[model samples]
Target: MPQTLFDKLWAPHVVADLGDDWALLHVDRVLLHDMSGARALTEVGERGYSLARPDLVFATPDHAVSSAPGRSSATFAGGARPIERLRQRVRETGIRLFDLGQPGHGIVHVMAPELAIVLPGTTLVCGDSHTCTNGGVGALAFGIGASELTHVLATQTLMQRRPRTMRLTFTGTLPPGVTAKDMILAAIGQLGTAGGTGFAVEYAGEAVRALPLEARLTLCNLSIEMGAKMGFCAPDDVTFAYLKGRRFAPTGAAWDAAVAAWRTLRSDDGAVFDREVAIDAGTIAPQITWGTSPEQVAPVTANVPYPAGPADQAALDYIGLAAGQALIGTPVDWVFIGSCTNSRLSDLRDAAAVLRGRKVAPHVTAWVVPGSETVKREAEAEGLHAQFLEAGFEWREPGCALCVCVNGESVPAGKRSVSTSNRNFVGRQGTGARTHLASPAMAAAAALAGAIVDVRSY
Candidate 1:
């Protein structure tokens, strides 16, 4: 029988088939962060259970850590308790932890791949929906709930239903200034947020195959935004090269063996999917969200959509948008170019290229938070920090700054921010604050103009 990439990665891990599409799938890696990790660990501890495979589990403090310069865990009001609890539990459980000020400290999704904690043909889970980001390296990754986390901790496996498979193939080349962020946003716009429900999506075709590893990571990072269980790109030489010499990646003979096995981790030539969609990458423009949901997106030149239904009208109201209002040139109060979705070095370089020799608008509060300390140091080496500082953008310490609003970082009430973060539910930034999602370049342009102008115009 022909096997898809998902099949190749999922089959070996299936320990039991419990009928009706359910199976017990072995979890190869388990990642936890401070926001939810502490509670889950405490629950298991209170129940008097020990981790089945402590060596396979890892924890980090990201969600509740302050991104303020020279920040301590206590920097954010209400942050210290969860962080301290996580430290105590991780110490008791014996799982490796990447705590604050550590090189491996970052958003769990960002740290997993860069540190090679996730690898090709593995099953990874975190108590984070964006754990799909690790799928970029060909891992089968998903977010599990607290109960499921406890289950994985005790059994090292999850009882799960098999998701139907979908393949979204992208053909043609993306135009300059259009990026992987644009491509995924365009798909969400076209397909609606629930379009990929009940499926695992594999991105393929010429454009996906051609994407650099970083871009591939960005593409997979948004799979959950579209309601998919996970999304992944097949691991090729590009994936192998990116993982080489990483802190946790295999070395020497182990590296050679790993690459050889990864080569066979793709779909067989004749394998079929339950559903498939093809996209013309050339047609995608720099995209931005106009409403609360990620699917309420349009190209930079587009207007806020007039309501097609009551739901659409409700979305417009929540976002403080008037029907048919033009989004381009609309004023924004802030600009943020950081998140687990787009705070990598490549994302920073692209935004910095636009910010060089330019100044931010006087009224716009702009910030750039790197995804990890390692990414921050590397960007500094390349002088990207100077470019942002000279342009009046606050360069923040690496963490989930302004993305999840968990650590006292937030947009002021009633202010609209153009942000590179994923998700823009009403008050996602703060009470009464509105968020407009965009690529790093688009966010940078908004910072410069104090308005949502087209990045191409810059």
Candidate 2:
């Protein structure tokens, strides 16, 4: 069979095929974050339905919580109360939750794979778009709307249409300063936000294999931005090694068996894909968005592109950025690093390397957040926290603070922020907050320079 990775993952879950395109798919894992779970649980209760397999589901408090530096709690002290009530609900339901203040508490995407909850030949769903982030472990992972979330909560199955298969092949080595974030941002810019609609993208070639598992997660995290329902990579040794010691990982003989099964998760030689895209790693520059869409991006060393003839002038005017201005020296009001997309300890270490001895610019309000409680503790033990604070950055507790304005932790409107989070859509960070998405390194560079600047030189 000329099957792609997506085909391999999707075929196993098919329960029945409906005329035209829909099918009933059996879901193996239902992963939901704090806020989305609460909403879905409420909706499920409103309709009087019970979860069929609570044990197969996992919930965590990440998005609405604060991942601020030095914060020991999972639920923020001053944040949304309803969110915590929901985390309690997950626990009350006997759902295994990485609750606030727990060792593994952090972004669900980062936490799931680290615990080995997302393994080969599994189907995972979450309410968050970046659920695709887990695809790095060779699982079929995707996001769903609140309605689909409620359905999954009610009955561990979902009605879905199979997505087309797309293969992205990367060759050569990335430059020293480029990170996974740069690769994904470049992908989004190349394909446009809607490019991968109805497709599942499988990343391959030397460039992908060269990335660390966490970096691969960052690469798959933005698959939704390209309109994919799901995305994944092949399971390999890097995935197994990172998963070996996590709390929920398989142990002893089970671990050996699991690894043995995972070895066959990749596309076989001569396997075919519905679509293919090729990228040369050497030419890709450090990337950042200039406008409302993730696709409206330019190289860090390039200028904000000018739109031709007639276009969304509203977005252009709102950013207060005239056409053709170089992004390298553009001033910024805030800088944020630490989101589900790039909040791992490695991400913190990369940013810290840039700010090690340099002070943050006087006018920049900068913050660093670790993805999980374990990540928070690890970074603190290594003095990454001290370096950031010494640089005049505000060290916050662990939660998804400012990753979005969900918890009132927003950058004040009209202020431009260079962020490490995924989306830069209008009002995504906060209403009217001009968001320029970049890698942790680039965000760190912006914080120190008080503007969007190429991180390579630093």
Candidate 3:
């Protein structure tokens, strides 16, 4: 009996089959953020519903917090109203909260794996789409809507259908400047934004195996953009090693038991996937988005996509960009390299690799916000913080910061920012602000040149 990793994971969590693309699925973990708690709790109050597995639920306020370095003021347009409301909701529900300034405070996705709350073979649910980020740890994790989140909060079971499976396999080695971010962006570009709809994607091959834990998260984090409901990697020695000493991981005899359990979580030899996409790491370069959709991407030295197939005419016009024109050397107003997608400690190190001894272009406003205080501390200890500052980039505190514009942080209107954060939808960074998503290393190169320079040559 051959089973794909997706099938192996999906089988354990299935509760019932309910025709019409829905199945009763059991949840192993429920992650929530400040904004989501407000709506979910208010719904719980209105509907008189109670949490199914209250002990497994946790809350944090990272999404809307100010990443203003050492600034205490949570100043945004709402001025902490959202934060207070979320705090009130979490308190009312009696759920454990990492809170704003706590050691575990950070993007829900980044914080989960670091705490070891996301173990192999578990099913994790959250209100944020990037929850797929946890799939790096061999878990089935992804975002749900507010309504679905409320349902999960009250009922640890979800009405979800098993998705089709897609396996992304890559062999050989990645070229320098090419990263998991680029690999994922390339996957999304190849499949287009709608490629993974109603599917769970498992990454395999020599390239995927070579990636570090943080890099795998970057690959899985964007599964949503490809329209996948879940993304995961199979558990292996590398996975066990990465989890063995994490904050919330098992200890002593329990730790031994946990490791034993994790060791068995791999695809059966005959496992099957509904679909698969194979890529070569050598073919992938540092990728960057040229338009609103994550699918509108190209290699660093490549030109913007022309009207291929059916494309967004308006989006192509909005940036005032044309097909076949190179993005390299195009002047950029800002460069941001922080987000759940690329704000981890390793991400900073990668950026610092390119930023060392090189100054940011005078015309570019550069910012680097660590994903968590833990990441911040580690970066500073390693002097990566000093490297960023010396390169003229703002070495700021940890939080969602400009990634969500949930805080006061925002790019001025009409400014084009080369950001490492996920999603470059229209005005996603701010009102009328334009964003281009790329890997952190590519971001550092762009910051140095103050434009969209191809990193293949950097």
Instruction: Say which candidate scores most in TM-score.
Output: 1
> Relative to the unseen true structure, what is the C-alpha lDDT of residue 19 in candidate 1, on a scale of 0 to 100?
91
Candidates' C-alpha lDDT: 0.91, 0.83, 0.85
Residue 2 shift from truth in candidate 2, angstroms: 2.9
The runs of at least 3 residues in candidate 3 whose Cα sits more than 4 Å from the true structure, single-residue gaps closed, are 17-21, 77-79, 309-312
In model 2, state the lDDT of residue 290: 83
Cα miss at 163, model 1 (Å)?
0.4
Local accuracy of candidate 1 as per-residue lDDT tens digits, 71-100: 988998688998989999998988999887
Off by over 4 Å in 1: none
Residues 370-441 of candidate 3 have per-residue lDDT tens digits of 987788888999999999999999988777877778777898898889999888888789888888899998
Candidate 3 or 2, higher TM-score = 3
- Candidate with the greatest lDDT versus the true structure: 1
Across 112-158, the per-residue lDDT of candidate 2 in tens digits comes to 88777888789989998889998988899999999998888888889
Ranking by lDDT: 1, 3, 2
Task: Give the Cα error of residue 224 in candidate 2, in Å.
Answer: 1.0
